[model samples]
Target: MTFAFDNAPVWLDLLGVFFFAVSGSLLAARKHIDIVGSLLLASLVGLGGGVIRDIILNTGPPAAFTTPAYLVPPVLATALVYFLFPYVQRYTSMLTLFDAGGLALFCMTGTIKALASGMNPVASVLLGVTTAVGGGLLRDVTANEVPELFNPKSIYAVPAFVGSAMTSALWVFGLFNVLTAAVVAAVVFAFRVLAWRRSWQAPLAVNGWQRRSSDPKP
Candidate 1:
């Protein structure tokens, strides 16, 4: 069915890639990684999620590999960070914003792609969230840091889930157009950034007897 979104905005896709690449390069700066490593990390985080989703759907070679256009954002992002990270380092919150943008976008796009590939709503949602967080997982693992997806410090995956769930529901109801998708992405970005800023967290395991909330940092 081709997702019925054949005209999906190219700029939106590239914007997501750029945002994620910026975040990944910023992390490389924090870790004191070299320029080559920064470019690799940026590309990995920018394209890793889409590649995972495509593989899961049995699609042809991932779009990141097939489409040269997809490669540009990460390269540009890495270069920008490489030259300007010293000044950019002062704004730590920018990292969160970039990550939130990618998370917001990939969650929705991944869900719709899954649905277009004939996956059920539940499975689509799962893959969608996976697509949203897969890049950060790869970036963290490569950098030898705890993945935000699983880190107890932040409610990262939860926001991805919220976006994926909304996207799935929207599709199921025939409301998943370009405009609506943008709306959903916006909501997700806001949710994720707010969650980070407000120190919102999900409940944690409590000996399998009950769950308990993590204390939000003041």
Candidate 2:
């Protein structure tokens, strides 16, 4: 597969990375972490996904490292969030929205990059999903909590999956080039926002947890 640099989506990718890093830093602050921990978490959330994507694609040092812009955005975001911890706490809802938007954008961008690298459709979709959620997975694990994706009530991974698949499908159909991919990203983002607004969730298991009568009581 041939690799061609596409400048159109780079800015969007950076914006997403910035927001995600900010979100991570805010979480650290909520946990009353020190500046160093905040910066570390922010950087991990910002570049973790891209690192995994690049490794899987066999591309040289993750783009986040090679591009000074990528490095700056996340660092700035981390500092901004750390300094504005009080304000962030007061506006928790807004922070969640920003995080959702970032997830949607990263998923789409990852898929596009994979496709451009000449990966198969399956690999592209998988990479996109990974890029969207890998950082969050790392964050959750670092925080010693269950990953959000495994929570049946959470819509996080679903939105990313939809966005990545939609973008890949559009590419296969040859509609609107990369711009269409952006549209798909927007759609995924909108879905997440709406889901949050409405508290939309996956159906829960019905009567699947009925304790067996023979089981010993705790």
Candidate 3:
């Protein structure tokens, strides 16, 4: 469960943070918030999940506090969005792709980090899912909207769960490495993007009585 602090994972993590920050900034723009709000939201979205993960792992202070790499991207992304909100909004597809990449990367890394910290496989997978979606959960709550993970409108958490589980399994089999991580992450990213493109959604509960009441008399 020990992890080597190599440069590759660090760079990949930073890349994911940047993408998450952009997605957060765009969401803030959609809410018509000011620059300060945009930056706050970006930071929340970019680092909130990782902070939660680190805290749960009992890792002191969280990586976000110790490293400027995690802190800088969100600020830069927020500034970019603040000046080019309208331009960024026009490219929804691209934004979604970036978000998917971030989600996949975070899920894999979260799982690895948790396992390295001696968590059980189940807990590691759950932490990975949280790392993938925690930021969006915070962003939604801050904006007073239902978290998308709980919403039936889109496929979000499922993809993260899949990626995290896959990563954990690979670790169990001793098949996990940097290359394997990249491949697993790509699978997750593609799966998520495909789900979005195909409008794949998780099913919602249907109350029979409510359905009957809403139906017209035959």
Lowest lDDT sum, 10 consecutive residues, model 1, at 209-218
Each prediction's whole-model lDDT (CA): 0.86, 0.77, 0.82
Worst 10-residue stretch by lDDT in candidate 2? 209-218
lDDT of 2 by residue, 1-218 (tens): 21234774587678878877887787788788888898888888878887888888887988887888888866897789767777758876765776787788888778888888899878899899999988878877786666766655466788888988987777666663556756777788898887766656665577556544663333
Roughly what TM-score does model 3 have, to 2 decimal places?
A: 0.87
Most accurate candidate by TM-score: 1
| Ten-residue stretch with the least lDDT total in model 3 | 209-218
Candidate 1's error at 167, in angstroms? 1.0
Q: Evaluate residue 107 in candidate 3 and report its C-alpha lDDT on the 0 to 100 scale.
A: 93
> Higher TM-score: candidate 1 or 3?
1
Candidate number of the best lDDT: 1
Cα error, residue 211 of model 1, in Å, equals 12
Q: Between prediction 2 and prediction 3, which has the larger TM-score?
A: 3
Number of clashing residue pairs in every model?
A: 0, 0, 0
